[model samples]
Target: MIIEIKVPSPGESITEVEIGSWLVEDGAVVAKDQEIAEVESDKATLTIVASEGGKIEIKAEEGEAVEVGAVVCTIDTSVEAPAAPAEPKEKEEAPEEEKEKPEAKAAEEKKSVPESSEHDKVKVTSVAKEMMKEHDLSLDDVINGLKRLGKKEVEAVVNAPQATAAAIPQKEATRDEERQRMSSLRRKLSARLISVKNETAMLTTFNEIDMSYVMDMRKKYQQKFVDIHGFKVGFMSFFTKAVATAMDFHPMVNAQIDGEEIVMPQFVDVGIAVSTPKGLMVPIVRNAESKSIPAIELEIKELAEKARNKKITVEELQGGTFTITNGGVFGSLLSTPILNPPQSGILGMHNIVERPVAVNGQVVIRPMMYVALSYDHRIIDGKDSVGFLVKLKELLENPERLFTGGKDAGELMLGI
Candidate 1:
């Protein structure tokens, strides 16, 4: 029997995808439901798995767009799995000391550095070559060291007519002639960010939160929770819940503008902005108000793993009423978050630092972090924005209120 593997629909509204790479070589006998190829859609990248055990025959080349229902590959289902190739013996193989220096292509093929430049590719870099090397970026990405080369003006490369047939003569590329195709995700992100900068009435409000209580709570429970769940319990869950609480009380902060009208949502679907190997994405948590600390931690763990593996989908990134970004994860002391448009607000979290503060007329040291909320000042007023952030600070200061509220406080806070 022959099995025709077709490109499945990547997501709702995404009808097509580009074949990023093939995991299995042609004529390799693969196990049933084994991943054979990687497909990158506009929103995410997913594996194309073989449905039946067979000798895999690849039909699609890498970097070509394929639509849903298009045949990607075929498998001769009758072929048995090939025996594993024997490892080369030490006596037959040359030692590493005898090996010659690896070329740029060899280094790229090995993927020792993930951000390696494609053949004859150019990358736009801000810093100088000396500065780049100091930052440990010697040869990872093709950050055209044009400045180091003493070139007064550097030009962007455009694709020339590529050699397609074996009969066609391959042209030796000049140092000045190379093409750099932008990834689909990068293009979309660029357009979205540019639109946000242009269209929205955006403004950022800032405040700092005392980390004393939350830090103490984590120091106490982190070990226990990690032992129980085999994962470290962190401050993100606590902050996520606190944001939810604040959003519940201040609906305008959690909503978006539909032209002349305001679109208000009753539930808090918090979008946590995660930076993946590919790009930045905001995957949302539905009804975050109901999730416990443990639940939030687990979901965060799973989502982060998915993001790293490029397994998150477009649907997962859509419909976020608000967004939360942790610049602290990248060791950021403080930053004003760029508001994710359609949604009115985005919260930026900074690293915790020991700072002096007045407590009851006495100065003392406390672990403090600066938090900034960038919102559309058009709908979310200065008072409500300040009030919402104040509520966030109160929740972080006293986390036990999440478990228990003072009589009417529960209804008021939760909108129950």
Candidate 2:
């Protein structure tokens, strides 16, 4: 009996997937539930596992596009397991001695020859040959002198005050090139990016936040906060909380344009854009408005881990009121992030740098971060977008108010 293995559906609307790699070789025996191939969908990478123990017969090749429920391989369950090898009979001492002598002699001969000699041939550049001729130098002279001769080497020898013998090339650095088909995830990302640009009336508004307070707070309470919450209180939670809070005053930035109607949700499902090997995955931090700072940090960490590990589910990836992407992690100074579809806004976070700025009437050095909010102009007015960013800046700059409802929000939230 042969058990046919078919591709499993990775997510909704993802009917096709590219076969990534095969973990087992054809005709190799595999156990039940053993991972055999990696399948890449537009959104995620999934594993194809053997259904039962048997020899595998590959029906699909790597880098090939396979559809959901399509047969990828088969397991020959009827084939018997390979029998264990029989023990060898004791060898005669005379035969063993004879084998040892030949093996030792071969190894000694191998050691006598230098491995470098095997790859001594090198491509001689035209410039180098011309220089050699000009300098009246032989190829062997150049080769024997330097043991390496290129255009640079030839020039160096020629330019030197005294003429030197050319060194023979020993192993040329071969220039190799390769081309591979793009994965489904990369292709999907490109198409989605293009669609977003073409479909939405996108506009970006920029503002800088003073990180002096946030930095001081983190320095003082990062350890305590991590001890209390089992996760460090990073800049993301502050920005996420700020965005959620700012949405309360400027709802238009959070509302998405649905045909002629603008749809607004009562809750804030903030999408935290996570960069994974497959591509960029936005996992929602569901009801971000209602969660505490500690809770938000924990959820973000888990969601990000899941996204990176390809363990995140489709439900987690779908539906968000807005998105926040921190290009700062990759040392980006500033970038105008694109709006995720249906969501009116995406907040871009950049690296923090210490710079001189005016505080009150005097110039003072402060740690600052440039933040950009890209929103759909169709639903979000310029005033609302700018106001939302201003509010976010204020919230992040003075983050104590983030936990409180904005009263004389105590500085204790910042460990002050």
Model 2 agreement with the true structure over 60-82: per-residue lDDT tens digits? 99999878999999999987656
Q: What TM-score does prediction 2 earn?
A: 0.73
lDDT: worst 10-residue window of model 2: 110-119
Model 1: per-residue Cα lDDT at residue 202: 84
- Candidate 2 to native Cα RMSD, angstroms: 11.1
Clashing pairs in 1: none
How far is 284's C-alpha from truth in model 1 (Å)? 1.2
Tell me how far the alpha carbon of residue 28 in candidate 1 is from the true structure, in angstroms, after superposition: 3.9
User: What overall lDDT goes with each candidate model?
Assistant: 0.81, 0.84
Model 2 alpha-carbon drift over 4 Å, by segment: 31-33, 51-54, 76-176, 406-416
